[model samples]
Target: MSMIFSWRRRRAGRGRAGKDEFPDMELSIPTHFRCPISLDLMKDPVTMCTGITYDRGSIEKWINAGNNTCPVTNQVLRSFDQIPNHAIRKMIQDWCVENKSYGIERIPTPRIPITPCDVSEICSRIEAAAQRQDAKKCLDLLKKMKNLAKESERNKRCIVQNGAGCALAACFELFASFSIEEYTDFLKEILSALTWTFPLGDKGKSKLGSAISLRCIALFLKGDDLSSRKHAVLVLKELISEDQDFVNSLMEIEGIVEALFQIVKVPICPTATKASLVVLYRMTLSENSEMITLKFVDMGLIPCILEILVDGDKSICEKALGILDSISSRDQGREGMYENALTMPLLIKKILRVSDMATRFVVSILWKLCMGENENAVVEAMQLGAFEKLLVVLQVGCGERTKSKVTELLKLMNLYKDELDCFASSARFKFLKRPN
Candidate 1:
């Protein structure tokens, strides 16, 4: 109906022709052909040797306007030397008139409906059912409300921003706290629904999924309920073990690891770095330690770990070192593992350039890490020429307390033990000996 009015308007405009002449305008089509670009019967048909036919007039106009390519693949098309035959033009026009919606552009999707559910009302009913101590009634109501919400969403009529909030409230109303069995049931359902929200090819969706999953995992790990924690672990294991690229790609997401790191990085957080360190610790425990090592190594996990260490997030820094310890311990006889130490020189140089006190402190822990079979690492440090720089930092020149700490570290390594006896004859040592 709208199309009929639009066509009439277009005809009226064409009748009021310009003072200058215009090219003959006609729609055309080759029999049994359609434009892949427009997904419509072809008009102003231009033939290719490959037997592909196109609408030349539209193609030319698009090219002159600087498009210069097929509408589908953007492949360049040569000039249209042969105009389409009149018979073809008539066929396309007849078809367009018969199917008035042909060649019509599609409208964009409507916005998601913002019909907010009355959270309090839902909560009241759930609470009332729970007060009656009717477990079945409470569960049934939860299931019913969830289904209703889903239906409303499918119909584009409701917005429930936090699904977990609703589920949590319902669980609280029922038991004042849910049991592991009950909590697991709710989490499994919520996670399943949440997973469905991911859109194909959406980087934002990928990030959102990872974030929500992380949050759920954190809450589960924190909750005293054993079943919830077990379920959370199960979910995390599934996520980490997924062969699908979509989920695994979350590792490449920026701030993802950092976000998880921040929570576990704090020394004050109970079980701080516990869950995270356990994850790293377990990876090295796999029967195929080499596979996990190589995988993390490729993801630049070592650099990230080193960065965390340099951040002086003490627990996480120590945790990362522990992870390194476990992996390196396994690679003792393995030729492939020693090469990882090669990164130490680069890490040391970067640490030396940083001005943070916490960073230097954490980096100093390298003394502890590099204690045994670290001749290669010591050589690398020396090659980077950090020993003299470190010794200089150890003297009275560095920050007063930090200098003491540095000197202590140097002593721990026996770095200047031989030189100290030789230093007794030096002019600087004599001057120091005479000083107050």
Candidate 2:
């Protein structure tokens, strides 16, 4: 009887294996093998406090999204501790091995997840090193943290959530008060680490927005290290506040504007260029916009902006145009624009070429250049087929303000119509039809 029973069990096992070999056979996976959150086969099964098992990656994503309850049971979790369900993982691996003929692959063992406790310990060590002014120790710890952040998004979130941002910010504030030559490496490391914690909390932003912090960043901007310069500008972009007083305070930093303009004149990267443009734009938002605009003009900002408008991507072009429009509000700014040979043609080309925002900016800039007793600007517009583009702007539709500006521009160009007849008759303007 025993021998017969053993034979029957072997027959049943073989029968299942034979069925699994068929291509069309539907393999019914065990229900417990699938994660509740993702409904996929568990690669790294972990049991939560609620006794429900889920794939580690899936549950961590759910927790990272700010959910505190078990996804399946909807029960509020008392603790986030996830224990590895080694038994289920082993079983899943065994099932995969048995179904290898069906193309199932075994799940590899998952690495240990970085808990908040691990991040907190590292942050504490960093803070201690900063307090003691141990530059070497601080550098090593920061590099360690940087490597961890690079490992995975989960690690980055863990580092930031565990107060690494504030720790690094405090380090910056402390070291920035000292001479730049004394702690160059440490400051660079701090800036690099702080950048990884972007979209920082309010506390970190406040700490970095201080005068000392800004001064340190300005010094880095003047440094020869390309990576540090890029990091400095990126960090500065995040620290810009809406307060007019705060915005004006940036001007007081010696050589700050010139440093940013240097980055624009000779871009280190597209990101740095955009960031410098953003900082310059925010500076113009203050009450002293005229003085600031004149300063920018003196620094040859007009030509740089025109060059960017010629070939920059859409976002960069929009930002560059915004700066140009602000600069054009003054006489010196208009003079600077006229001095650039590409100014009129480039602005006209961008009229309907880029985004709606770009078109509005171009129109505003043209209006500024042509508004005063500048018949030269009007003639230039007419000769360049600005009349046709303006008409198209009206026909294609635009904002009410843009429509008003285009109407005014058309009326101005009409005054020069007789003189522009030959120019308008050119093949370039052949497609143009005057609006009634």
Candidate 3:
């Protein structure tokens, strides 16, 4: 984001004042002389995957805005990355030099972008420092790697290949052997680095999946440092997303589930809370492990999930609802949810509140509850106005599975037709509308 501002100032003045300050050349400049995206003379021009050229700032902004298609081509981009168009940039610079009498400022040459080799060199240095037990040097290298990775997706892959995970694991092992008081801050720095470079690939995951790294990862879950805790959960979330085997490994750690439960309950960072829920959902993907479900209930995860369901952000809501759908498939989880007062209404509210993904989970949870022994969950659904919403959802539209779940709940609700006589025929639920 700061890059956008820096490019703007380097172009001329702030905002549209550059034009007013130098009005002589606006008409003389050919349309092709301007960036199609920014409508200003090219500065640091770069070509994108769509084979379209744009000023670096404008194309970057477009990608940052979550648009991965070319504005001109309207073609799906092969990659979101920008390649610097050095030839086009030279033409722009030469034109500016030719138009100096018209007050056009020749755009300065952009700094040479760091290459994969540069990141690899830094990693080599970090590894050398590690072999010598040079903690300061290794820490400095890790900081530089973090900055390089953050600069571009291309750099992230380069850093990963350079053994970032192995480097971080070495840092953890080094800190573990040191007197705790002396290396606590470096340990935090290493965890912070892990947080920033999450979702590492096979090479990195092989290193992070080691027993030492798992134990070290769990330590942050128990510590007092809020940032470290957030990093731990987010890193775990990324790991779980990539590999269910990693999720199984996490389940073996003594206090991992409890620690995750604690994170959801304590809620230091919103992202951490979402991440912990995401991890739980991922772990639940394993085969029918009744003990895991029982353990989740024992850690008091049900209320925490439901509480977060009420107030969590989109991703958090999606994950919390997903876990609820999974856990409610078991007897103990269903019993725990039934006991919580907010669980039903909030689950009902979540139907159309967050996303279709969440709506699917919500409907599935209701279906699980309704499928359980008799009308307790059904009666509760009626009390929460779920039947009306379900009917409306069925009437308008939803995914096939979601529609199936809604249909099942409606069938069960109709079984108690005598009890629902007043409720179903009444005008109370008539105002309900389907979600878009």
Candidate 4:
């Protein structure tokens, strides 16, 4: 019941406010059609406990302005609750319709505010369906709940306060042990609803039992349906991002980490790829689990990550660089870095072509490889045209930190003129002189 009414002029048999049409005639509004407070047509008319009816917006403004008295009667209000004057509202709509030639549009039906009782009743039905293993009934109720929550933030809070989160979690657990082949479609609908309601920061995610969630969601990631797997990863991403305990306990869940790697490695979709990459990045960064880091390199993720860095989306490239930088800082990870023949050339190509943060990461990965306290490392980079890229950056402007790295890398590799002469002899751009 919160529609704004304003006068518009008629032009070309259409309702539009224009210079010539508005002055064609001055239409008068009935006094009863106007709010005593604002003199505007009452869109959402309501009666105060003082028996005075006013437009809801006007009365709310007057009350909010610190006057507890009725604007018309000037009598003190014992209670401030405003009851909707539906009869008056219908009259207003009828009048607007009857005045269609005057260009007044019909007001839309106002949505009744969802109460806590509504949330509780829905939650109860969902919980009962879960207990009975009625997948169809549970899906219907959860879909309704998700729709109601999407109506407004107030509805979302009411749903959570009335136990929607816990109810969804319980349903997830009840359906956990079932095979995907048997309950694939039902599980997809259920997980979608769970993910929808999961971001409320309610204690339900934790109270729903982490072990149960981790196991069930991990299994969902292996399902045949693509959307369910994607939704499962996203839900896991949001759920685990806040809890460090879950990050450490990840190793305990057999295949949870593998599922994430699979999704990141061969994602069913771009969203899934990005979400999985982000989750992996956050988990590895949050906890410096050396075992996890080594396992990442051991699984041949470095090569896969290098491919992603070469061809992924701009946002995904930045995240892939961040992940590679983290994992490549170790001895084993360093080995994995140069093990892929395309790594250095791809890294060189991206030097100045990406965002500043990505450029910095590319340089960091190179530094880790070249400065692994080995002379061959620098020579390897020089052979791959990294030397020329470094010289170009030195000639042009670059960040101070990146320039320092380039200078240090050059200093460590600086050697006899004959080393350059020898390198120049075999260079593809043999006539291309190095920048002074």
Candidate 5:
């Protein structure tokens, strides 16, 4: 008769005699779990053929649950499917297999195994090869560096997960080893490789792809070749247009707007909207006004922009306002696209009607905008019956210094100048007159 060993007893890996031969031996429950079908702890857990249990049901219940192991061999089983479909369980299991703690997860990649080589030493050799202009030697050293990068990436998967530091270091070494004319293709190839650019750890996975892509992009930009810079811009733009999750982070890239007009369509994500606007602002800031008016204003982006002004996120609201102010400041052929954007009367109307503090802040931003160019915003401020509110804020009894600033502003609106004396007579500067 086959001995019926309890799951715990099997995990204990004891002999049939149950005598403690190796008393202190510690056994690990395999990170790869077993199948319940064959009544065995899983050796190689496949989904259907050999179920790797995902959810480790209570061990006592799993063992007692009894229908465990490879049903094919009536023999007591060692392989069983890990059950349940919890994403965290597999993550934990993968972490264990990598010998990594949850706090530090590694992004995995396939690496060429080479003996432990000091990257710094390798970098020195690569640089020397490049200096000698020995193309063959340089190529050889580059291959070795690539191998080192691969190995480093593999090792980092369990440790750093995103391997951003390792990837950058490796890219830098490769960069040092090649002349621009000889290495442009090589850099392009590496950046294009889908396998090489991901982040290292589980936590880093979401941001890793963009981060690494940006690094490659930065390197490309530094190359003397304008064509290469253009190509790099294309790649980054493609990534932004496609990857919704990465939109916000991608917006943070420096000098990104250098390629803004190349994008024909807008990304659907709000972050992308904000990013695109930022790029637009930077590009047009110093350019001729026709570019701003013909490109952005004529394209009818103002409405979409106004919608962003109403957004609840404070930073986004502020950024939008700032961009609008930038537009207002541009020469723009001395044309009115800037006012076309602010549409002051419409905005002031919303400000008076909208109740959210954020909206009020947004209105305040519009007020500031009008205060500047001294025309479009002022006309709209006068038309919207904003004078009373402006006067009230300017007068005492509202809030803090903001009120004082508004009062000063009302003094400047000229439309209120004649009426100011009439208003001042009724309300005492008495609030200011009140004892401190």
Candidate 6:
């Protein structure tokens, strides 16, 4: 049997060659060695329960895309477990060695996949160290987990699935009370790891929402380590999103709002900036939001948001506009918008330019500022082409609420048309006639 097998292998090696298989040497690649999914020679072959072998990377990608059946056999995958086809791998490697002269390189041995058991062991060690108050060991383990998460999305899913998130949250809660000067490294590592293990279950979110956790995160926000500060903002955004009650505790933390505003003012990254904006928006949703809005107005949030409006991308602009609209609900917020010189021009420029949602926000802000006793805002907006922009918004399409505001703004403009020097003679005035 061995002789026959060797003879057949040699005969297969000399079989008919395909033009595309080995362009330079015209070598024949056995069809059995190619993966059914990719039609390429399988490197790191894995066998699914359906007895179909595919390249590990290809099959894993298929499953990650939410496929539950084997690609070739169309059989339901009873289990996700993929067994290594060592014999096929060995055969492929030997074939590559035989074809070394044709430029085929040998595939390196694949590393052992990270399993739930491996993650559980790591979490166990982290929990034990936290119990013993072993800051050094905990930091080392956290660094390991961070590195692992960086390796692949698979490792990250495994780590989070195996209770790594809860373990890290517990460590953060325990270590956060210590002196920042002493446990700064350990605490930073925990924050970094927690950022990777996001979409945390309710338990993890609850632990992270504790007052102690809020306080620690606030300190990190003010810390000089830009990475830690960004991570803290991201984690804070997650916590506030999961539990609205935590916003009350967050508001109580000294300097938290100011820190978030500073990040918005001088963004560390786009992600951090958006997260800060979201946290600020959530603060405006709390019961004491009137007070919060007043606080934001005092802290120069209006000008900061206007700056973002000037250059922010679509999504960030939407968030900034949401916060601004929230702030505009308060008397102080409207006053702040009126006081800033660039506010009118920026808001006018954004009227029909950004998006429908953004247009709605700008219209609401303009309505809040102009509908009141402030005539200069109306005059300023008219001078800055607000009349024509509203015309364009009408000519195009807008939300019903936005269309109503535009109509009211136009009537308000008409009330001042005779008073304003530029309104009567302008050709655009005809377009402002009231829509029946």
The TM-score leader among the candidates is 6
Task: Name the lDDT of candidate 3.
Answer: 0.77
Q: How well is each residue in 1-436 modelled by candidate 2, as lDDT tens digits?
A: 0111011112234535552222254466787998888878899899999999999889999998999999999999999999999999999999889977666788887767677898888878977987887878888888888888877677788888888888788778877776567998889889987776765566776777788888888889988999999999888776673233556778888888899999999999999999999989887777788888899999888888888887899989999999988888888889998887898899888988989999999999899999877998888877788999999999999999999999999998998897667665686677889899
lDDT of each: 0.47, 0.84, 0.77, 0.76, 0.46, 0.86
Ranking 1 against 4 by TM-score, winner: 4
lDDT of 2: 0.84
Query: What local lDDT score does residue 244 receive in model 3, on the 0 to 100 scale?
Result: 80
> For model 6, how does the per-residue alpha-carbon lDDT over 81-164 read when each residue is reduced to its tens digit?
989999999999999899776667898877667899999999899989988989989888888887787777778788988889
TM-score, candidate 1, is 0.30
Q: Mind giving the per-residue lDDT tens digits that candidate 1 earns over 1-436?
A: 0112122113224556655443444434334546554545554565543334565545555555786555665556575243444455566566656545334332222223222355445545656766675566656655655665565343222223423244333434234234435555544444433333222123323332354445545565455554444444434434444323423343444443443444343332434344455455455555556656666555555655555555544455455655665555444312233455545654455444445443354344445344445555555555555556577555425566556555554554456434543654574566565546
Give me the displacement of residue 320 in model 3, in angstroms. Answer: 1.1
Clash count, predicted structure 5: 43
User: lDDT score, residue 298, model 2?
Assistant: 90
- On lDDT, who's better, 5 or 6? 6
Model 1 misplacement above 4 A: 1-105, 108-117, 123-184, 190-275, 278-361, 367-436
lDDT (tens digit, per residue) of candidate 5 on 127-206 = 56545655456456556555455554333332223343344334433453444446666665434332343432333233
Cα RMSD of all models vs. native, in order, equals 20.3, 8.1, 8.4, 8.1, 18.1, 7.8
State every prediction's TM-score relative to the real structure: 0.30, 0.77, 0.75, 0.66, 0.37, 0.83
Candidate numbers sorted by TM-score from highest down: 6, 2, 3, 4, 5, 1
The residue-level lDDT of candidate 5 at 242 comes to 42
Worst 10 residues of 6 by lDDT: 1-10
Backbone clash numbers for all candidates listed:
2, 0, 0, 0, 43, 0
- Sequence-dependent TM-score of model 5: 0.37
